[model samples]
Target chain A: MHTLDVALGERSYPIHIGRGLLDDPAPILARLKTPRVALVTNDRVGPLYLERVQHGLERAGVRCTAVVLPDGEAHKDWPTLNLVFDALLGARCERSTTLIALGGGVVGDMAGFAAATYQRGMPFMQMPTTLLSQVDSSVGGKTAINHPLGKNMIGAFYQPRLVIADTATLDTLPDRELKAGVAEVIKYGLIRDAAFFAWLEDNLERILARDPDVLAQAIERSCRNKAEVVAADETERGERALLNLGHTFGHAIETGLGYGEWLHGEAVAAGTVMAARLSRDLGWLGEGDLDRLVALFERAGLPVQGPKLGAERYLELMAHDKKVEDGRLRLVLLDGIGASRVSDAAAPERIAAAIEACCA
Target chain B: MHTLDVALGERSYPIHIGRGLLDDPAPILARLKTPRVALVTNDRVGPLYLERVQHGLERAGVRCTAVVLPDGEAHKDWPTLNLVFDALLGARCERSTTLIALGGGVVGDMAGFAAATYQRGMPFMQMPTTLLSQVDSSVGGKTAINHPLGKNMIGAFYQPRLVIADTATLDTLPDRELKAGVAEVIKYGLIRDAAFFAWLEDNLERILARDPDVLAQAIERSCRNKAEVVAADETERGERALLNLGHTFGHAIETGLGYGEWLHGEAVAAGTVMAARLSRDLGWLGEGDLDRLVALFERAGLPVQGPKLGAERYLELMAHDKKVEDGRLRLVLLDGIGASRVSDAAAPERIAAAIEACCA
Candidate 1:
């Protein structure tokens, strides 16, 4: 087992990366000073692992209640988030009662958001069940639920008390979802770690096959990169924006494709390719690097081309993205793998050309 | 103007209390680096003072967009909150955009929560327009919305960049609402400020008349008391619980009666009386002090008795209150006005007796 701590003073928590960490509740439960707990999961994850988590928590002398929400991004809304509070209140959960999120990005985000707002805030542990959640969403303190107006429009920078990424759960994730997770994994490489990208290129098949060792290394590296970024820019005031490399364009795709139709990682996979092309046009990235990025995404069975949303519609949707500032589009562009910068000065023609090329 | 800072290190902000402060947004706006502003208010507050605040912000070169929500406590929910984000997003608000809440407790809490969640949080200024808000809700940074199951079931302790309580807004407030605001004003005295309590007893009438000088003193003292409590315990971890003197019982009343039926202050007024009576029975407070507390509540025209929810139902409702821990009832009992302790060991029979006495 490998542990990386996100140094946030009193808010600091360890990210445990291993094969069966979920079965061991001692460390996670030890961090929680309370005896009562509410386990938040989704239909896709509850039947598979919620019982085991409940058993572990109960054995540790903690009372437990489970709130199983419908599984999907479509269910990540206010009504769904309220179900968590309803379950907590019905069970008479107190502020000291901890929440354990036992699912993928949707569950983690919604459950974390529920914990953030449940009685102002409560300690929660992230037990991410999917690749995307295990590597990216689970490590960052960013918790949110999608608003009808925009994705992740309502949320808070609420960090978890602990993050337990059990590699065993990845066995149950569908192939498409696994590839989706790899999209985020690749994101870290393209934005801030060339060595990690090189490693991913070499071990892509091993990760695809759910090799525990390969998967563990990938998750650990992604979390380490994210933890470092989050520690320095806890609230995304500056350097944290680099983490949104393809998110500006990805959010537009997710919203335009009618969220949940395309997985977040899949949209991001395509968005990153578009962002790389934009970087090439801006002369910040070479054609060879862009080709390698596209090849990697293609090998992972992810899209390297944007959806057929025209430039005008793409601009409209991206305008609603949370990253936009004062009517100006802010794009996270690649200076080179392992480095990134956020800029709104990219000419409209360049952005349009990249959009057209990626869509075509 | 009297300026008292809520000393939370980097999160610290100044609370400016005085008459005619609303006309001067220079100090507050000067601290904010954003030139784009989103003004969040309600229909009632919009026509009354939104123009002046907007003019002030705009005159200072800050582009402002006003989002007017429905008026009253009933509107403090997800739907209304979504409107604020919609307006901000429609205006292309970035993470740097500042949100100015320009109404009462409802607007302040909703807007503050919106700011806390918008793009993981944006700078917000509390331009509290009502007495209840200026003294209590605005100063503490406890932002939330009532859930169908309970009051403040969802929220965060997101502090604002600045709090501008223009005492002049009180002139336009209704008499009932003015009395409601005094309930919180009376709270500071009951929790940990005996001298302040004595001052309220002496100047209750003057404060009701909206006496500029008296009102300013009252607001400043209330904020200073709250700021001190919050600084000592920002997350309501220890000493801060004392500030929730009547909140435990008050939340039960609000939840039992259905939010918006009784104004927050009215419910808190009755809750305070109940808490004092219970404190007296526990031998922590004298009968004379309880009578004095009840008299103050009555003079403010606030409810001194709770609704006819039976003892069993009250217990059930209070159990669901966020304050309850490990199935033990945690009540903030008064040792004396301005001195309180959170005790769960108080006898159930004594609590039942206090409830019976108050209801009778």
Candidate 2:
């Protein structure tokens, strides 16, 4: 097992990465001093792993209530978030009551956000059940639900009390979902660690196959990198924006395609490839680098191309993305495989050309 | 002007309390390194004060785009919040854009929450136009919109970069609204400062009359008290909960009555009276203490009795209040005129009697 701490002082929490950790609730529930808890999950994840978490919490002598929300990215909005509050209220949960988010990115984000606002903030534990959540969403403390105007338009940088990432959960994730999680794992390497990227290049298949050891290592490294970035920039003021390497483009795709159609990780995968291509076109990277990114994404069985939304619609969708500023589209482009920078000065024509190339 | 710093490190901001501070934008706009801003106000406050703030910001070389939302607590929900976002996006506001919230608690909370979430948070100034906002809501960064299920069900604690409380704006406020603000001012005295409570008792009429110096001092003292508590417990872990002294009860009143029918301060005014009475019944407070609280609320022309929602219904309403935890009702009872404690052990019979006492 590997551990990383997101240092937010009193809000600080640990990300524990390993296989079979889900069955062990000591680390996650130990921090919750409350006697009662409400485990928030979704229909998809609840039937699979809810019992394991509920049993772990129950064994700890904590009374638990499980709320199963409908599963999907489209459901990650105000209405669904309200359901969380309704369930908590129905259970008569209070300020001291802890909320356990036991699912993928959508569930974690919504549950964490509900915790963040419930009674003006409550302690929550993140037991991420999806590969995507383990590596990215569950670590950063960025909890939010999407708004019709934009994704994650309403949220907070509220840290959880603990994050328990049991690699075994990934064993049941669909192949596409597994590939999606790998996209974020690949992101850490593409943005900050060439060595890790090389490791990913060598172990992509093992990760896809849910090899416990390799998956645990990858989740740990990804969390460590994310934890450091979040600790330094808890609110994504500057350096943290580097973590959104493919997100600006990815958000455009997600929104343009009507959010749930393409999995966030899949869109991010295609977006990363596009970002690398744009970097190459803008003379920031070599063609070989773009090819390497494309090959890695393909090897992970993730998409390397976005929907055929024209440049104008893409621009409109990108404008609504959380990344754009003052209507000047800011793209997080790779300076190389191991570093990234957010730039609004990237020529629109070049970006449009890259989008065209990716779609074509 | 008396200034109090919220001490949230980078998120720390100053609350400037005095007469005519709105005319002086130098200190408030100083934090805005950018040249553009978007001022969010509402119909009631727009024609009265938005232009003055716009002039102040423009004179300070900050281009301003003003968005006027409908006035009322009922309007402080998602649709109204979206208006502010749309105006900013239409104006091509950047992440560095600073939002100036120039209205009462509704506008301040909604705009602050918008700033907190827009582009993953941005700097905003609170130009509180109502007495309630100036004293309480504007000082702490607890911004939110009412969910259909409850008031402030959706929001964040994103502090403002500057809180500009123009005592002058209160002059244009309706008598009832002005009285509502006093409820919060009285709250500070009840929970933490006996001396301030005594002063409020003596000067309630002058404040209601909009006496500039008296109002300024009242605003300054309330803000200072809130700032001290917030600095001690930024996330409401302990002392900060004291700030919600009347809020738990007040939230029930607002939610039970279907929000906006009674101004927030009016509900709080009545709720504080109920809390004081409850404390006395529980032997935590004396008769004189309850009378003093009731006297202060009456002097402010605020409600002393809750709506005639049956005791059973009030209990049902209180049960859903964010303060209730694990089916245990946590009441913030007054230790005296100026001290409070959050206790979940308060007997249900005593609480029921208090609610019954408040029934008309």
Candidate 3:
């Protein structure tokens, strides 16, 4: 197991990455404020591992209750989030009862937010069961639920006490989901780690084949990059904006297509291509660099093109993005294969053209 | 005008307590990151002051939009909160747009929570018109909505950029509400300010008569006490819990009677008497001190006796309080007239007897 700490002063916590970590309760037990916890998962992931985790904690004399929400990003709204609250309140869970999230990004996000708002604030832990969550959403403290008008429109920047990334769980992830996870893995490399980008290019097939060691290494590297960015700019005032390299466009696609139609990483993959195209038009990235970026996403079996939402519709949806400041849309565009920056340099015409060119 | 700063480091903000502070937009303008704002008010308070505040900001060239919600504590729930989010999203309000809450505690809380969660967060300002909000809720940064099971079960500890306590608005406040506000005013004195308690006892009639000078002085002192407690412990780890002296029992009464049935301060007034009775029963407070506390409530036109919900029901409701930890109920008991501490010393039967004794 490899433990990397996200240095956030008093909010700092360790991210544990390894195989079979979920079956072992010591890491979670060590971090819990009390011997009681409420585990939040979704219908998809809960049925698979909830009993094992519950029994494991119970064996150690820790009381555990499970709150299984409906699966999918579409369910990531207030009504679904309230299920967790209803269960906790119904059981009379106190502020000290640690809330453990055991699932993918949607469950983790909803549970983290529930912990953040429930009883003002409560101890939260994340046990991400998918690669997409392990490498990105589960590491950062950004917890949110979608609004009909925009994705992640209502949320909070609440950090978890610990994140348990058990790589063994990835074996159960479907091929499409695994490929979607790689989309975010590629994000770290495109944003800052050029060498990791090359490493992914070389070992994409090994990761696809579910090689345990390679997968763990990739997860650790991605978390290290994210942890550094979060530590430096926890609230996304400046440096952290770079981490949203393709998210501005990606979120538009998700909201435009309706959440869950395309996986988050899949939308990001297509959005990254659009961002690269716009960056190329601005002379920040070369054609060769853009081609390589697209090729890497395609090689991982991810979508490299967005849905057929008109340029105007995409722009309108993107306008509602959290990154929009004073009505100015800030896009994270690639400066090179290994570097990116939040830019307002691209004109509306150029952005529309890029979106049009990259759409299916 | 008295401007006192709540020292919370970067989160610190000034509380402007005086007449007509809301009409003058300079303090709010200076604190805003953008020239845009969304004013959130309730039906009851909107007709009274919404246009004046909006016109003041608009006249100063600040783009202002108004979101008026249904009046009363019953509406302080998710559906009502969604109205604010809907208005903001509909108006395409950016995260930088300042959200000014221009009403009482319900409006302030719903709006503050909206600002805290809208697009992860936005700039929040409090224009507290009611004396209860100005002297208590507006100063503390405790924003929340009530759950069916408990009051403030879902919320956040989000501070505002500036607090404009317009004492002039209190002229329109009803006699009952004015007395309701006094309940919280007396709370600050009972918990930590013996001299202030004595002052309130001597000048209670003047405050009830709405003497501008005495009212402002009372609001300033109440804010000073609350600000100190909040600044020292923003998340309510220790010292801040003392500030919740009567809140546990108070929340129970509020929840038991079905939110809008009684004003929050009225429930708290009755709760305070119950707490003092329990404290005296435990030999922590003298009989005379308890009588004085009840006398002050009676003089303020507040309810000193709670509704006959039965001690068992009150105990059941109080169990769901935020103060409960590890299945143990931590009650804030008075050591004397002006001193309080969180204690687990009272037995359940003793608490029930005290509740029975204090109920109507």
Which residue pairs in candidate 3 have backbone atoms (N, alpha carbon, C) closer than 3 angstroms, thus clashing?
Answer: none
TM-score of each: 0.97, 0.94, 0.99
**Of 1 and 3, the candidate ranking higher by DockQ:** 3
lDDT of 2 by residue, A275-345 (tens): 89999888888878888889999998889998999987777777776666655788888888887888887
TM-score of chain B of each: 0.97, 0.96, 0.99
Tell me the lDDT of model 2 at A68. Answer: 96
Question: After superposition, which runs of candidate 3 have C-alpha atoms over 4 Å from their true positions?
Answer: none
TM-score of chain B of 2: 0.96
Window of ten residues with lowest summed lDDT in model 2 chain A: A319-328
Interface RMSD of each: 1.4, 2.5, 0.7
* Tens digit of per-residue lDDT, candidate 3, span B265-299: 99999999999999999999999999899999999
Candidate 1 residue lDDT tens string, A1-360 = 999999999889999888888889888767886788899999889999998989998998889999999999999998899888889888888888899999999999999999998999888889999999999999888889887667898888898999999999999999999999999999999989999999999999999999989999999999999999999989877889889888878888888888798899988988898899999889999988988999999999998888898988888877777667666788999888777889897877778889889985
- When candidate 2 is compared with the true two-chain complex, its DockQ is 0.51
Question: How do the residues B1-360 of candidate 2 rate in per-residue lDDT, one tens digit apiece?
Answer: 777788887778877777787788788666885777888988988998888878987887788888999989889887788788778767667678888898888998899888887766778888888888888888878888887667887677888888888787887888888888888888899998999989988998899888888988988888888888888888776878888877777888888888789999888888888888888888889888888788778767788998888777777777777666557888889879787999987777778899889868
**Model 3 chain A, poorest ten-residue lDDT window?**
A320-329
Q: Which stretches of model 1 miss by more than 4 angstroms?
A: none
Number of the top TM-score candidate? 3
